[model samples]
Target: MNLGYILVVDDEPEIRRLVQEILEDEHYKVAVADGAEPARALYQKQRPDLVLLDIWMPGTDGISLLKEWSSGGRPEVPVIMMSGHGTVETAVEATRLGAYDFIEKPLSMGKLLVTVERALAAERMRRENVRLKRAAEPDTFLIGKSALMQRLREDVERIALSESWVLIVGEPGTGRAGAARYVHYHSARSDRPLVEVSLGAVPPPNVAVKLFGAEQGEAITPGSFEQADDGTLVLNDVVELAAATQLQLLHAFQERRFMRVGGREPVPLDARIIAISDLSLPDAVAEGRFREDLYYRLNVVPLRLPPLRDHREDVPELLNLYVDWLVDNERLAYRRFTTGAVNALRHHPWPGNIRELKNVVQRLLILNRGDEITEAEVEQALGGRPRAVDSAPQTLFNLPLREARDLFEKAYLEHHLGRTGGNVAEVARLSEMERTHLYRKLKNLGINPKAVKEP
Candidate 1:
C-alpha cells in the first residue's frame, strides 16, 4: 500500500537512487529525476504529493527551478530542499522560495523519513483547510419533512445516479446550492473534490480565467474546472454571467473540453457541472439575459426547488433543525419554540424562503433570553403581525365601526413603526401626521414605539 506519491530530484545518481529506495521502502511511490529539466517535466506530469529537490543540480539549479515553480504563487505540492554543500544562505533562499523544509545531504535516514512524513501531513492539513473554507455553509443537505421536500430529496437522489449535468432553479434562499451539494455527496464521484464558485460574485473581466484557468509560460493556475476535475463544480448564480462568458461556457460544454485563458491546448472537461440560478433559465433566455444554447446544455436534468411558502408544513421541522443546528454549531443559546410560535411561523409568508426562516430562528434564539420562544417573540423577530391578523381584513367587518376603526389604526401604525424601526418621527412623516398627534394616537392605541423597534 503506497502512502503517497513522491518525486526525488538530484543530479548525483547515488543520491537519487538512495532517496528513491528509502522512500519506496517506506511504502511511498517514488519517481526520480537526474536534472532540473527532467525534474520539471516529472513534477508537471506527476504532480507528486511531495518533492525532494537537490539544490546543486547541473543546469537551472534547484533554487532557480523552485523560483519557476513558485512564480505563479506557492506551489501546491510541498518541496523539501536537499543539499550536499549546506549553507545558511542557501537554506534561507530555498525556504523563501516556498520549499517545505531545508534538508542537508549526507541524509540521516531517520530524519529524512520523519521530515517526509511531516511534509505530507502538513500538505494534507493545508488542503483540508482550503476545502473547508471553500465548502463552508450552514447545512450541506436540506432540512424538511413536507411532501414537497420529500419529493425534492427523491429527485435529487435519482439525479445523483446519472452523470448528466444539473440545473437547479429556485427563488432566492430556496437552498438551490444545498440541493446541488446533496446531489454531489450522493454521486459516484463523492470522494473527489466538490468545488463551488459563484459566477455572480466574480467580476466579468476575470470570469474566463476563473473558470478555465490561466497559463502564462511556465506559470500555470488551475481554475475551478480543473480543481474539480473528477468531482463536481457548482456554479452559483450562473445566469449572472456575461454574454461572452455564456458563449464560452456553451462552447466548452459542446466540445467537452476547454483551453486555459492563454494556452492553446484543450483540457478535458471531466467534472460534473451543477448550475444554480434564482431565475428560471427559460425565462432568462426569453428575456435575452441568458443564452438559449447554454441553457439547453445545463438544463439537461432540471431540478426546481420549491419555495418555503409552498412547503409551509415543514416550517416547524425546519425551525427545530435550524435551532438545534445554530445551538450546536454556533454555540448559541438553545430555546424551544412553543406550539403557538410554531403555528404562527407555519402560517407566515416566507418571501425570503428558508434562508429568512433560519435567520429568524437565529435572531429569536439570540435576542430572547427566555427558555421557550413564544408567538409574540416570533412575531417580533419576523418584524410583522401574525398572518391571520394581517391577511384577514374580512374579520374586521364584524366589529362595530368605532372598534374596527381603532383596530385598523393600531395595525396600520404598528406596520409603519416596524418599517421605521420604531422611529415615531419617520412614521409620522410618512403618514403625514404631526409628531405630537401621532405620539398621542400611539399612546391611545397602546402601541409602544420602543417595543416595536427591531433588535
Candidate 2:
C-alpha cells in the first residue's frame, strides 16, 4: 500500500525521475511536475500529502508558485524547497511563505527521507489536534462511580468492539460528544481520524456538501465522510438535518457508497457512523422530523447517556475532576470546595447537565478569590438556591418576612435567568416586570447577567 501521496516538481527531467523513483521505492505514491503550471494542475486534481518544489523552475518560479498557494491562508500540505544554489535570504523567504523546510541539492536521500517522515508526522498531529478540539472535551473519560455510570461505561466499551453504526441519545450537554470520543479512542480504529460535523451549526443549503464533500472541476473539498474514512464520523445534532439530506444519507448508507456534491464517481463509505441527538430517533420519526429508514439503520447499537440529576451521587467526583482539570490545564488557582458547597451543588438541579456543571466550576474558580469555596459562593455562582435534601422546614421560612421575601425574589429571578440563558429582557417578560426594573433587581441580588449565560 502507498504510505502517502507526494508531488515532486523540478525543471530537470532527470531530477524529477530520480526523486520520484526514490520516493516510490520508499512505498510512496509519487506525482512529478516539470514546471509551475503542471504542478498547480496536479495539485488541484488530487491534493498530495506533501510537495517537493524546486526553486529555479522556468516560467513561474518556485517562490511565485509558493506565494500563489500560500495566498489563501496556510497551504494544506507541507512544501519543502530544493535548490542547488540556495541563499539564506531565499530560504527565509520560503519559510515566511510557509514552506516546511529548505534543503540544499544535490539532495541527501537520508535527510530527505527523514524530513519527509517528520513533515507527514507533523501534519497528522496538526489534524488530530483540530479534530479533538472540534469533536471532544478535554477529558474524554467518563468520570463517575454510580451504578448508572458504571453500566454506561460497560455499554460504551462493548459498543466500541463492534463495527455497527451507533446512535447516542441524551439531553443536551449530557456528555454525548464526549461519549462518542470515548468510543473512538477505545476502538480498533483509534489511529484513524475522528471527524465530527455539527449538523445544527451548518446551514441547510450546505449540509450535503459538508457531509459528502464537493468536487468543482479539479478543486476537491473532502467532507466529513471522506475525512473520517477507516475511522469514526460523528453526526452531531442529527435531528437538525433536513428531510432531503436525510433521504440522501439513507441512500448512501444503503448502497455503502456516496457521491460528492459535484462529482459522478462513487466513493465507498468506509467510516463508522456515530449519530448523536438530544431527542430520541423514534420520537423524531414519530413526529415526522426524522427519517424512519435512516433511524433503523443508525440505531443498530443505541447508547443512552443519563443526565447529571439522575446520577446525583457522582456530583462530588465530577466537581473534583473538573477542579483538578481546570487547575492543571487552565492554570486557574487551586481552590477546595467546602463540604457545604459540595452538598449544595449536589442538591441543585443541573438543567444544562455536565456542560453546565463544568462552566459553573470554572466560573466559581475565576470569580472567587478565597482558597475555599463556601455554600454561599456556590449558590451565587449557580444563580439559584440549592434545594434542601432533608425534610425539615426550609431556611426561607425561618427568616423575617422582608428578608424571606428578598431571598425568595433572588431565587425566583435567578431561576428564570438560568432558564432564559441569561437574557434579561426575556426574564423580564416572563416575570411580567419592566426590563429596567428587572435589571435593577438583578443587580440588587448580585446576579451577573453575563456570567449566568451558557458558554
Candidate 3:
C-alpha cells in the first residue's frame, strides 16, 4: 500500500524532481508543484498528507504562502520548510507558522526519509485524535446476546467484507441506521468517513441540491456523494425520497458520477452507497409509489433487522446497556432495575423497538428517583399500555391451527373490548355477536372485562 500522498513545492526543477523520485521510491504518492500558486490549486483538489516547501521562491515566497495557510480554511496537513541558506530567525518564523519541521538544503537522504515518516505519523495521530473526539457513541453497535442477535452479527460481518451496495429493511425505531453504520465500521473502508443523509428530513425544494450539490458563480458546494468519496454514503429513509430526487439518485447509481446542480463536468463517485428504509420497497414499487428501477438498484444486498419483540430475550441486556449509557453520557443518577422489573420489560411488547427502549430507559433514569427500578415503575413508564402477552405475529404461525385461532380470537376480542371501553353491548354490536355469547367468549379467552375498562 502507498504510505501517503506528499506534495513537493519548490521553484527548482532539479530539487522537485529529486524529492519526487526519493519519496516515490519509498512507496509514497508524490505531487510536485513548481510554485505556491500551483500548490494551492493541487491542495484544493486533493488534500495531501504532507508538504515539503522551499522557503525561497521566485513569486509568493514560502513565508508568505505559509502565512496564507495559517489563516482559517487552510488544509490540515503537515508542512516541512526547506531552505539552502537557513537562518535561525526564518526557522523560528516557520515554526510559529505551523511548519512541522525545518530542514536545511543539501538534504541528507536518510534524514529526509526519517523526517517524512515522522511527519506523516504525527499527522495520522492528530487526525485519529480528532476523529475519536467526534466519533459516534460506542453504544451504536447492536446490544444483545440472543441467538438471533448473534446470527445477525455474523451476517453483518460476512456482508461487510463485500463491495456491493446494501439496502437495510426494518420497522421504525428498529436501529436500521445503526446496522448500516455497523457494516461501514467493519468494512475495509472503515478508516474513511461515513456520510449520512436523511431523505425524509430534507425539504423537497432543497433535496436535489443537498444530494447532488449546487454551484453558483465561483462558489461550489460539494454534496453528500462527493463528501463521502472513498468512504460510505448512508441514505436514510431512502424510500421517502421525492420522485425527482429519486430519479437523480438512480442516474447517479447507474453512471457512478453526478454533475453539480449548475456544473457541466461530472464528479466521480468512489463511495460505497448504503440505503436504509423502514418501509417495504417492493410493496412501494408494486403500488407505483416508488420507482421500480431505483428500488432494484438499492436492493442489491438486503439486510432485514428483526424487531425487538422478535428477540425479547435480549431485553435485559439492552435495558442495562441503555441505563448505563444514560448514566454515563447524560450524567443521570445510576439506577438498576429490579429482577421483577426486568422480567416485566422482557414480557412487554416493545412497539417502538430499540429506539423506544432507549428513550424509556433514559426517561426512567431521569424522572424516577429510586436507585432500583420496580415493575410498577416500568408499567407507569410504558403508560400502562405494554402488551402482557408479548406475542409476535410470526409466533402465531408456528402454533397449531386451533391454538392460533384461540390466540387471534383472544387478541381480537381484547382489542375491540378495549376500543369499546369494556361495554359488552357496544362490543357485541361491533363483533356482530350476541351480548351473552360475547360474555362467554370473553370468559373463555380469560380476558378480564374490568382490565379493559376506562377510568
Q: Which one is best on lDDT?
A: 2
Q: Write the per-residue lDDT of candidate 3 for residues 53-161, one digit (tens) a residue.
A: 9999987888887776665343256889999988999999888889999999998878999999999888667756655654545543367898888888888888899
| TM-score comparison, 1 vs 2, better candidate | 1
> lDDT by residue for model 1 over 337-403, one digit each (tens)?
9999999899875545676677678778888987998998888765567542352242345443433
What is the descending lDDT order? 2, 1, 3
TM-score, candidate 1, is 0.73
Clashes of 3: 0
Mark the regions of model 1 whose C-alpha exceeds 4 Å error after superposition. Answer: 1-8, 12-48, 71-73, 106-118, 129-141, 186-188, 254-256, 287-289, 386-455
Winner on TM-score (1 vs 3):
1
Task: Point to the candidate with the largest TM-score.
Answer: 1
lDDT score for residue 210 of model 2: 93
Give each model a TM-score: 0.73, 0.71, 0.71
Q: lDDT per prediction?
A: 0.78, 0.80, 0.77
Q: Pick out the ten consecutive residues of candidate 1 with the lowest summed lDDT.
A: 387-396
